[model samples]
Target: MKRKKTLNMMSEEDFLFTFQHGDYKFVFEYDTPDEFREYLSELKDTVKELEAEKSYKRVQQIFKKEEQIEGEIKKGERPANKENFTFYDLETKFIVGKKKLEKVSASTYKAYEATFTKLKDFFKYERIENLNIEDFERFRDYLSTQVVNKTVNNHMAYVKMFVKWGNDRKLYPENNVQGVENLADSSPEIPHVNYTDKEIRNILEFEEFEQCYKDTFLIATRTGMRVNEICNIKNDDIKQDEETNIYYFDIKKSKTNAGVRQVPIHKDILERVLEIDFPLFPEKTDNASQKAILRQLYRVVKQGEGKFFHTFRGTFMNRCLKNYPRDLPIIQEIVGHEKEDKIKLSVDTYAKGYQLSLKKEILDSVSYY
Candidate 1:
């Protein structure tokens, strides 16, 4: 009797096995040498059975079995059919597991929840595995029609983040949407118009302007703090310098490391802030407060598309640069901006920062009156 070859095999590092059955070929991966040997032995036994039966149908069955085993070993803990895993499932895991683990603030959590809601609406119960780069690009196009370019970028950023998170866990093949670029506005960019000194005075003196909004605007204009930073200010954040006795905002919580610095409260709003018992705009959400401020601002001044609450920060920076052109580092520190110049970088590395009194002087120079 002539000897028959059971199976043709090639093994690499005892981790990968390649098998050829006539013209059909298959590959399998195993975690361990023992696993590879065990799988190979089982496959050999099946081949023997099929060959002895001399059934062509049984020979085709061998290839099917080989593919099934290959997929099973490669997937490991992942489900056999990832098609059932929806985008919503991955989102829920991220919200419940990763977000909770990070202990993000209420406002940040709300923002993430809002973004996830938009993603869910766009994806619409689609399998996460089925999502590809084209789908994300289409979602970006959909967002562009509905919101501004800036907002579309925000939504797309969240989508990329969520998709990458799912991919890390082997929920999908890969982060296929990672290559999707942010949408660029087709319209010409409108330069941000800083609120003029006269406009600043008009807004503050506006009869209909709410006290809280005024307070928030005042802080942003004087200290060059962002809208969210102004809104999140707490009573404890206000501190008095021991030597200078000048009151300043000790901003420990900020969006960036550069933002986490002390800024002097200009004397203009000092008494008003003290009288209000600090945190002048306490418990107000940044978004709602910003919209309310804009509505009141438009009532007093002519509505300019570029003029908004954030313009105050830019206006403040403009004043700082105009008044203290030589003190660029001081102005950068006051505005929580990362030092860009070599001189500023050296100063930042060696010196802690300019004194509170110096910072107060710089802020006092930023007067609209």
Candidate 2:
């Protein structure tokens, strides 16, 4: 019998060569000139076998991984599954994990949570794969049905914030929802600035809410503070004993960081607050029954006002312009506003009577009479 060629054949010279067919590419190496020839012969046969096995794509993928590892090793980088990455998937992960949401106020997070919930409901299936501008448009339409133009604008703002936040984490492309604009009249309708002190007194003087009403109204009136801000106020926040004495409440939360303040406690309000027995809205024993009772009480107590809670808030700002420093910037500071310039401009536009009063004060002080 003829001697068989060794399968692990070696020779004196070593050489390297590359082989390619269509998109598939590979390297062929041999120890010597004879083995280099042998490798080319074997490579051709291997390609024919791969073609017969219908694995052209598999062969290309193997070559690609090899190339990827080579480049990664040179760069001192670990290989990752690039195939698994996408904009939406990465964004969801970032929003749920890396976005320091705990630092955000509970109320602010509540609003974000509401907007996020709506997104979840709208994009229940394959949210990552299927989200588009039209999806946002659909969300806009849905929100329009639920709220007014101003509120719809707010939802849009929140959504934009969410998208930008997602972008910061390399979650999605920046300005992905760039075309969505704010409402035409973005300076929200200033909440019908007509609710007054007398109206507030009249509502609170009614028997139903009278028990806690005076306490509630006094806090709102004296400080130009928000309703929820007052509601969240703990009994420990009260610090004075006399009706005219000055004290301070550590304002823990508000619309912005500027809202955090040590508000002076008008003692009249402090004394009234000290008298309340429990939470203003105590839990009723029955479920639906309690809500119905409160609704009736709301109607009986706040007849003319469209919203009971907001009526107090409007009253606070209105009183700020009326009795307190009507200087727009001063008013903004008293109310813990971040942007004094905008407040001054808006207050100036709707504050003709106030401006006139200031002019009168100046004229009177000049001793021109």
Candidate 3:
């Protein structure tokens, strides 16, 4: 139905008409007959001449979102929240993150798995993206009940690592839980110290241990190698010098890439390395190697000491500092710590790696006398 009003006896107003735009009714009142006649003439021209009814009420509302997006690109405008990850929870993070990230070790991954499992049991909310500081704090309280202070602290560390990972990718933007601090370690500090020259001799000469232990322990003390690194050493890792008649152990792989360095063997320990054909500790795990090192440490250095195989590293560093305090790069190269050559650009990038002669000099300086 159409509604039209005629201005037969009206004062000064012209004729008007009403149209329906769906539920909304719009009435277009004419200002004057001349204007109305002009608009009707245009409408008639469109219908008769063009054969198209491109009128206002018949227009389709086309969205310009794609066009707007194209315009933004042309104007150098970037979009926000375009990351594909919805959010990674504890389980997914543990599985995927662990596999993808090489920095995290197997032991660290295990701890993360245990920590996340406990947290999952404690909390109802699944996705970490939705969690806030209060959620973590409450989780901390729950951890305090179930584990020792040290273990609870470890749980907190795991949570912080996960949160940091999420924040880096803008996943857990609100989970900046800074208050989850570690508890103070109340246990008595065990005395980890450098083994005296005589104690080193005693450990080397200990009758209870086999020749293999003496061979490996001597290598560890001289080269400042971790017990794990020592255990993993293969026969192929040993390389000899053509000029100096000096032999070297190439630590081709280790805990960190930084740990991969060639160490010149001491004259005193070189004879023992010659006889080694198998892996230093073929079937031994890190835990087993640690237990053996601790047992020997207790015997040689006496009980209640914090020192293990790692004490050799500190001992080597101490000797280096005493003799050549400023030579940090050398000591760091010998051990698995970060080295200077890795960061600084050299004049000759091709010759940037340390030469065997320079390596020999450094090892000789730090040698046990």
Itemize residue pairs with steric clashes in candidate 3: none
Model 3 is weakest, by summed lDDT over 10 consecutive residues, at 76-85
What TM-score against the true fold does each predicted structure earn?
A: 0.68, 0.53, 0.66
Best by TM-score: 1
- Tens digit per residue, CA lDDT, model 1, 267-324: 8889877766555555656566556666866786666467776787789999998998
lDDT of 3 by residue, 185-241 (tens): 666777778877776777777887776677777887788888777877788888887
Regions of model 1 farther than 4 Å from truth: 1-85, 96-111, 141-154, 181-184, 341-350
Per-residue accuracy of model 2 over 42-127 as CA lDDT, tens digit each: 88898898786677778888789657555543332222422233333433443444334444544555677677677666665443
Best by lDDT: 1
Measured over all alpha carbons after superposition, the RMSD of each candidate to the real structure, in angstroms, is: 24.8, 26.1, 27.9
In every candidate, how many clashes are there?
0, 1, 0
Error of 2 at 205 (Å): 0.8
Q: Scored by CA lDDT, what does every candidate get?
A: 0.76, 0.55, 0.66
Runs in model 2 lying further than 4 Å from the true structure: 1-107, 125-131, 138-154, 181-191, 240-245, 277-297, 300-308, 324-331, 339-369
10 residues in a row with least lDDT, candidate 1:
1-10
Considering summed lDDT, which 10 consecutive residues are worst modelled in model 2?
360-369
